[model samples]
Target: MNWIILIIAGLFETGFATCLGKAQETEGRESLYWWFGFGSCLFVSMFLMYKSISGENAIPIGTAYAVWTGIGAVGGVLAGIFIFSEPATFWRIFFVITLIASVVGLKAVSS
Candidate 1:
């Protein structure tokens, strides 16, 4: 399903974002791994985004893009807290929840 593929793309968006952070944190052979990881994830994310927006599903471009970025933003924040030990402030969690709700709302209203 297109929705499923969109969700996968969003997850890959999260992957690339987190990998980017890891890549920035160090240098040399280990950083190379993160860079490669970021590249692979970015490729898949874009590929799936294309699939979801094109062909039969034909979701509106703006809608698809918003949902994709919404997922990435929320997932990235969670990853920052859990994986990177970033502060888990109340306002941050509240906004993340709202973003998630918006993503779901878009999906529910879509054809």
Candidate 2:
């Protein structure tokens, strides 16, 4: 359950990043709206992360954080490619795959 919450929080991290990117490409009220989205996602993401570390058998902070940022980083790159049409080069995709493996490995070894 904590892992699920962690994953959701990481996804919200992606949401905030994507919103910030959207905000960058807009202006005036439109940009403000994106910023609002960014803020909302940020809050939710942070709150979830905090929640994930609670309870008796909470995840070690180091592992939890690494997984959280791992998900966020991978999601960010994918968002940049799909949503923002950033480059989908070989090396980028390769690294993304490796990062995903690393994140999953972190989960597999964690208890």
lDDT of each residue in 7-60, candidate 2, tens digit only: 999999999999999999999999999999999999999999998999866888
lDDT score at residue 102, model 2, on the 0-100 scale: 92
List the candidates' TM-scores in order. Answer: 0.97, 0.97
In model 2, the Cα lDDT at residue 41 comes to: 97
lDDT of 2: 0.95
Give the lowest summed-lDDT range of ten residues in model 1: 54-63
lDDT of each: 0.95, 0.95
* Clash pairs detected, candidate 2: none
Supply candidate 1's per-residue lDDT for 21. Answer: 95
Model 1 vs. true fold: TM: 0.97
**Stretches of model 1 off by over 4 angstroms after superposition:** none
- Residue 52 lDDT, candidate 2, scale 0-100: 91
